[model samples]
Target: MNTGDLHLLTGAYVLHALPPEEHADFERHLPGCPSCSEEVRELAATTGKLASAVAVVPPPVLKQRVMARVAAERQAPPVVPRQSRRGGTRRGRALSRFALAASVAAAATFGSVALWQYQEAQDARDAARRTERRAADLASVLAAPDAKAVSGGFAKGATGTVVVSRTLDKAAFLASGLPNPPEGKVYQLWFADGGSMRSAGLMDVSGATGAAVMEGPLDGASGIGVTVEPAGGSAQPTSDPLALLTLPA
Candidate 1:
């Protein structure tokens, strides 16, 4: 019922070999346990891939061969010694609780690792999707009859110009006057259409004049915005945007 036991059964669960009672218990637990569910999902995905890579069928004589090997090795001495611990009944109960707690902690650690890996995989997939969308937008812009290279800058100390040309399915964001981010922080670029925003990429603000070029299919995109975010940009902007450029839609 706890995480450690779930971790121990992850492989067997993926293989559909868990005992009926344990399998039912896990099904009930997984819905409320995000970490364990994530691990199970990732493990299942991995095992599915492995299954496709190899076709393994035991040979017809495998049972006979296994029996022969077992007979030859049966002569070996017992590896594990049989021993019994001496303890009070109360001490034994305490030990049982200790073991359960330890198992839970172990399961939590494993669940964390598995969830982290799954997140990495999900991020990679999102990035790929963004790239594809960007490409399509650029292609559309470049195909426009009036599309030509245009350059513009801010009215005050803020500076930079974007080269927008319908001849190419892409736009370049060139800027300066942005301050460098503090440790563990980053400048993030965003694409805005009327309804929502999407992360373009994390920008480096270490230099006086910073330029992060984003190439994506604009697909009726209205403008570009930049903000200070954590190391990785979020799906939604949390603070006021540092700069905004109206797209030559």
Candidate 2:
């Protein structure tokens, strides 16, 4: 079968509705097609949820009526085959194939929608977790007993603050009102202890405001400086500091 036809079977395969021969063929094709495999998994999960959430029970008399009809049909005389109706047989087969294709298309559409919803939900959850972590980190810095704040301005519109916890050995840079860097340049932080300068970290100042947290031994640094450096930042300061703040003695 063509790839499109094989993909159409994913919904049926997930529900265990495929014939044994087709099922085996799909299973073999699955290892090489990640798209089909993921579709099957998502559809299976949706099916499981539907099964668990809905309970259905037929009327007790329905079974008796079905059996009675079956008996009546079995007792009726079989119709003789019409050999001259070859064209009718072909037309009937064509109709059957069309119906089967329509059903497969509908099932595939439903499965694709379910998969998209599942992925969107997953992405939302991940974003929430990241936001929570960032909030917690900011709160911890703000609540620190020994936290000290330093502020400075770089260019005309650029300004920022550095919050440091001497005892906790952590520092956070909150930058705002900074212009976007020129191409192939980025803002970098430096810790100067009078004798030497150590790279604190790089800052992503792509927007009007951004923040970066530095964790390490920051107790001895006498000053914090910000400068524009090459994209990834340099091991040593290659440009004059655009913004500087002196820590308390």
Best by lDDT: 2
Candidate 2 lDDT for residue 133? 85
Q: Find the 10 residues in a row with the least total lDDT in model 2.
A: 72-81
Q: Tens digits of per-residue lDDT for model 1 on 78-193?
A: 11212312233334334333333343334444555666677788899999997787556645554556665434454357675554554564566667775667677777777787
The digit string of per-residue lDDT tens for model 2 on 83-189 reads 52354445433433343344344444554566667778889999999778866776777679988898888788788888887666777888889887889999888
Pick by TM-score: which candidate is best?
2
Check candidate 2 and list the clashing pairs: none
How many clashing residue pairs, candidate 2? 0
RMSD of each: 18.0, 16.1
Give lDDT for model 2: 0.68
TM-score of each candidate structure, all chains considered together: 0.38, 0.51
Error of 2 at 143 (Å): 1.6
